[model samples]
Structure formats: structure tokens, C-alpha cells
Target: MATLLHIDSSVFPGEASSTRSVADAFRATWEERHPQGTVIYRDLAAHPVPHITADAWSAGYAAAAERTPAQSAAFALRVELMEELERADAVLIGAPMYNFSIPSTLKAWLDNVLLLGRTAGETPSVEGTPTVVVASRGGSYTPGTPREGYEFVQNYLEAVLGGTMGLDVDFIVPELTMAGRNPALSALVPLYEASRERAFGEAVGRAKELAERFAA
Candidate 1:
């Protein structure tokens, strides 16, 4: 059976936020499809990693090639996060766009997971796996459209998650605030709900197919 890691970085818990709900829905669908598979969850909001400090940066650089005493000590805490991703057959990340960018907490988690020569490197195939990113945004960010100005989040994430790591990145975006006035929001509510369901179902299906093909 495959191992799946489900991560959520949304700070809000209730209806005020949709990231967690979206992630939960995805995890549920995946569980149903892969009954024998193991699913591990990490909530960054409840347990966040401190921002990378000077010491952490120094350790990371010092141990860029091999682990040192200082680097090993600092990296001990991050190893759990890295091991989780490394052992997983697939990864599902749910994050909300904050100020046209990803949350710092999520970025921190990425930094820990995208270790040199581990998750990525100068090698041709840096990433040895596939990942799906489900981004929840309050506005539309389709390029070439009027709201294209707000597309930095998706662009930045794709660059890091796909280009740098060489992971097959798939995205699901549920535009929330773009629906406009109360009446429009009311109309959009059902659409968002339906989109969430479809997105989760599709992700679960894809993950299952991948597991059967690669992990079997």
C-alpha cells in the first residue's frame, strides 16, 4: 500500500478559511479510494516551524553537501518533515494565497522539504516523485484577463514546486472573493462547494492511479 502525506497551512479553522476544508475533503476522498494506504496529516497552523534564523541558514549552508555537528543538530527537527515527504508515495498540499503569495509557514515547510541532493539537486531529475498543490484564493488570477495582476502566487509556487524541484505539479484553485457582491457570493457559494468536491475527487483518483502504476 502507498503512503500519502496531507498537509494544510491555513491559519483559520472555520468558514472564514477554505484551505483546510479543501485539504480535508481531498484526504477523505483519497482514504476512500486507497483503503489499505496509509495517510499522514500535518497541520502547520497548529504546529508551525519557526522562521529560518541566521543559525539555521548557516547550518543549511554548512551542511549543503554533508551533515555537520551544528547542521545535524538544527536539522533534527526538520528531519521528520523531510522523512514524511521522502517516504510518501504522493503529497497533497493545501495553502491559501496571502498577499498575492504563499504563506510564510508553508514556505518554511517547503524549505525544509526541498533539501539539496535529497528532494532536489543539480541532477537532471531532481524530484523523484509527484505532488499536487491545491491553492485557495480570495480573487481570480487568470493571466491575460483583467485580474491577471494577482497571479504571482501561482507563478511563484509553480516555479519553486515544479521548476526547481522537478515535481509534476497540478493545481486546483477555487476563486472566492472574485464572485463580488453578496448576491454574487451567494451564487458562487454552490460553485465553490462543487469545485471543491470535484477537485478532491480528481486528485484522489490521480493519486490512486499513480500508486498502482508506480508503487505496486
Candidate 2:
């Protein structure tokens, strides 16, 4: 059976989070299609992974047998994270924009898994792995927008997750998510609702397509 690694890095919960809902849509459809498959979930906001330390960095490159006690403990999480990624057939990430970038918790998790020989350095261990990222932004950053180049969540993830790590990434973005809620963005409420609907629709379609494509 195929395995999926579902990760949520949103600080907000429920209706307050667009990314979470989009990812949830994907998970729901995927689970229904593959009832026997396994889905491993990690809520980064609930249980954040620690940032990689100097000792952990050193230990990552060192031989397993050469690691000191401190290094061993520090690098243990990396081992677990790596194993999870390596074992998964697909990876789904719900990463909401935080100040135009991915949440620090997701970044910390990347640091733990994107190692020299484990994830990317030596020919990308998870190359061609289908990874979907539901990236939601409170403000618009599409073409012709004043802050076009300012969008970094999808760009950065595509570069690192696809360009560097060699994962086959597909992004579903819902922009202007705070339109109706945030007073400053109230004028864009109509656009926000439309984008939300389109995003969720695409999320379900893409998830089902992927699940069926990889189902055994």
C-alpha cells in the first residue's frame, strides 16, 4: 500500500486557516480512494520540530558510529524525519504564508530532513516524489500585482523542494485569504470567496488524481 506524509504548519486552526482546509480536502479525498493506504500526519503547529543545532549539523555529516552522545541525541530527530520522508510515496504540506514566507516550524522541519546525503546532497534521495503544497496567502501576489516579486512561499518551496530536493511539486495557492476577515482587505471579499472555491476544488481534484495515479 502507498504511504502519504501529510504535514500541517499553520498556526491557525479550523476555518481560520485556508491552507489547513485545502490540505484537509486533499486528505479526505485521498483517504476515501485509498482506504487501506497509510497516512502519516505531523502537525507542526501543535508539535514543532526543533531547529537543527551545530552539534546536529556536525553529527549529520559524521559516521553514525562516530557521533558523540550529545550529537546522537541532537540528531535523532533528523533520523526519524528522514525515515518518514524516505518511506513515503507522497508528501502533502499545508504551509500558510507568514510575512511572505513559510512558517518557521516548516523551515525547521526542512532543516532536519534536507541533509547532505539523506534528502538532497547526494543525488536527491526522494527525487521524483510527488509533493503537493497548499500555500495560502492573506494578500494577492499574482502577476501585475504590486508585490509580484515579493511572494516567496511558493517560489522558495519550489526551489528547495523541487529544484534542490528533486521532488515533483504541485502547488495550489489561495490568495487574499484575509479579504473578508481583515478590515484592510475587506474590499476584496468577492475575489477571496472565488479564490477559496477554486482552490478547494483544485485541491480535491488534484488529490484524487494523485491518489489514483499512485494507488497500487
Instruction: Go through the candidates in order and give each one's C-alpha lDDT.
Output: 0.72, 0.92
Candidate 2 residue lDDT tens string, 92-202: 999899998999999999999998777996498999999999999999999999999999998999999998899999999998988887998898999999999999999
Expressed as tens digits, the lDDT of each residue in 102-214 for candidate 1 is 88889898877666666666752336566778787876677675678877777887888788777777787766644544565676776656665676676667656665665
Model 1 local distance difference test score: 0.72
**Candidate 2 colliding pairs:** none
lDDT of 1 at 60: 54
Give the best candidate by lDDT.
2
TM-score of model 1 relative to the true fold? 0.81
lDDT of 2 at 210: 90
